[model samples]
Target: MTDPWNPADPGVLRLPSGRLVRGRGLRRPLDGSAPTPSYALYLLGRQPPPVTWEFRWIRWPDFRLPADRAEARAALTEAWERAAGERVEIACGGGRGRTGTALACLAVLDGVPAEEAVDFVRSHYDRRAVETPWQKRYVRRF
Candidate 1:
């Protein structure tokens, strides 16, 4: 199904099940015209700013790895489920490493093989995604 928000942004990733979840850089300005997400997952080492949308923050360091695996998994799973019917977005500082890692995990949850999730994310979302080796390894483990 086409996303009601039509989040045609730079980091949107459309999963195999047609779930549309956008991945973006938190540093970038949110487009006022863009549709607000019903749920937003923020991957950051620091606390995220307060927002009107239902949100979750995963203690993920930029260019590094997620601080908590179990929590990250739960959050990503929740994000995956929400993406099926709601406007769900995953974002981080630069929106490449942590964001892409989360997106890859969501792809894995959506039935993409864990081994191929990172490549799938890169090919469909961003070529420079999943920046570090550990991040790619994390996707494989996801």
Candidate 2:
């Protein structure tokens, strides 16, 4: 079995239930010092570059919602489930919008109220997470 992510890792966010999911920006260089994720979810409008580890890609354009809401749900749910016993990472080009939105949804799955999930992520992950008003609304309705 894979080991869990270090809560102190640069992009790791510890959910209220103690699951650790790392959210990152594809625009930034990955910190080489951090351990790689056992599984990852990449949110992008187009196919992303392949990696050595297992991964999934959702056609989620930058600053926008996922193209297939159902696919996003399944992918995020899988990511959250794996994070309990593996290092799972969720990433988008800029990481704040799509990544943050997905993280909030995972928060909801982890038992955070949908209305409060966004705040929970912003407080523990990035201060500017869930970038747009619609994204915040999405979290609320998740």
**Model 1 stretches with alpha carbons more than 4 Å out:** 1-3
In model 2, where do residues sit more than 4 Å from their true spots?
A: none
lDDT by candidate, in order shown: 0.88, 0.91
Worst 10 residues of 1 by lDDT: 1-10
Predicted structure with the largest TM-score when compared to the true one: 2
lDDT of 1 by residue, 12-39 (tens): 7889998888888889978887777889
The digit string of per-residue lDDT tens for model 2 on 1-142 reads: 7888888877799998899999999888776777888999999999999888999999998888999988898999999999989989999998889999999999999999999999998999999999999889888887
